[model samples]
Target: MATVRRKCFISYHHADQDAVNQFVRDFDQAHNCFIARGLGEEMPGDVINSNNTDYVMAKIRERFLADSTVTIVLLGRCTWARRYVDWEIQSSLRRGQYSTPNGLLGIKLPSYSGSFPERFNQNLSSDFPRIDCYARHMSYPSSTSALVDAIEEAYQRRTTHQNLIVNPRARMSYNRQCQ
Candidate 1:
């Protein structure tokens, strides 16, 4: 049997596209990665520049929603106010697909000045259950390392869940199994 490649969907504001692209490059070099922006390169010129918002959103939904096993939302300074970003997060959560120990991950991109974006504070009161959130300074060399670590951790959790499902008896038979 062929091994299934794990694909991740990246959600970010267009203003942060450069940074997001860099992250995507690093991730693709290290692991199996996919981003809707990159995928747009394959489309016809007119389709790529279409002014129809619904058509564009439908394309994004069809491609990313269907293919990706995980969604990574890159939280930038204005990310909270971006309607599309908010919609993406809400839609992903509503899909009832990705979840903790197996699904979506949220990474907060610290400002260039090595501080959390002010907007993050404003939106701190909002509730998001499916997102596994983390913050790292974009200016630090270890920023990418932190993201890589989170990805690995999420993969491990997913692997453990898969194991449990594949051999439910093993978990049930364990001496430490919950009573």
Candidate 2:
């Protein structure tokens, strides 16, 4: 049987670049169940200052998140508060014009215990079962098999839900999301 590697879009806060760097390093050392090379850790300086929200999103969808089947959000202190992260989350769920909606999961950063993104918490609230709920999350440095299962599970769950888009923690769009 041939082993398949899922393309994973890593959604994270810039502040947690070190952790993401380590995460990618560890991923490279694994049995190779994922492909995360489309997008780099940092956005180009010109793109950062472009201030073209629509263009940026289109580029992200077509270039980076394209062909990816799952998205893993590296949860940090303020992951939910980031505008780009929010956009990424939303775009990942919607199956954009040029991109498919990737399955979702959250990985709590190593050595850090923090709350999951607010959008993912709506299901827990007594708001009559939110239509858009968050994806299940776990801690980082998890076993390759476990992480693979999570991604596969998310993929299966999406098929069943057939359009489940969870709420995002921050506003959907902005002229400038993060600095």
Candidate 3:
């Protein structure tokens, strides 16, 4: 039997490029999934304008994730705090004009220390209750097969978990910086 290659969007903190690079390389070597698109250092803007923001986000949807079937989030130290990552995740979850909800997965980098961004904080209902816990994890580095399985699982979830919608509470904000 042949391994399935999913169209995967690589989401990561700009500060953690090397980790995601290695992940891409490994996935390619194994034919686990295709690196269909990526979210890198390009920020929305220094100033927040709704029109520009909407335009940029639309471009992201059309260019980056419009064809992807899954989004593999490489969770580095500051990934949880980055607004772009939140926006990417939010965008990935929509079943709208851009694209249907892509499968979602979160991986903890070697530097992970259990602190996650509010978006992944499964238990923040009082503040902004998230869908909670679908993020798979491993303490050490992840293997290609592991990620492939995760991608497929997330793909499967889009059908099973109709509850996975954009959480208004976890919305991204440019004014805030990670502490």
- In order of appearance, the predictions have TM-scores of 0.52, 0.76, 0.76
Write model 3 residue lDDT over 63-152, tens digit each, in one string. Answer: 777888877777777788777777777777777553457777777877665666665454123344533444444443456676667778
Ranking by lDDT: 2, 3, 1
Candidate 1 per-residue C-alpha lDDT over 104-158 given as tens digits, one digit per residue, 9 for 90 to 100: 4556555322222232222222345633332112232355445555555544544
Worst 10 residues of 2 by lDDT: 40-49
Candidate 3's TM-score = 0.76
User: What lDDT would candidate 3 get against the real structure?
Assistant: 0.64
Clashing pairs in 2: none
- Whole-model Cα lDDT per candidate? 0.44, 0.65, 0.64
Name the 10 consecutive residues with the lowest summed lDDT in model 1.
166-175
Off by over 4 Å in 1: 1-5, 30-57, 96-102, 112-149, 152-179
User: For this target, which candidate reaches the highest lDDT against the unseen true structure?
Assistant: 2
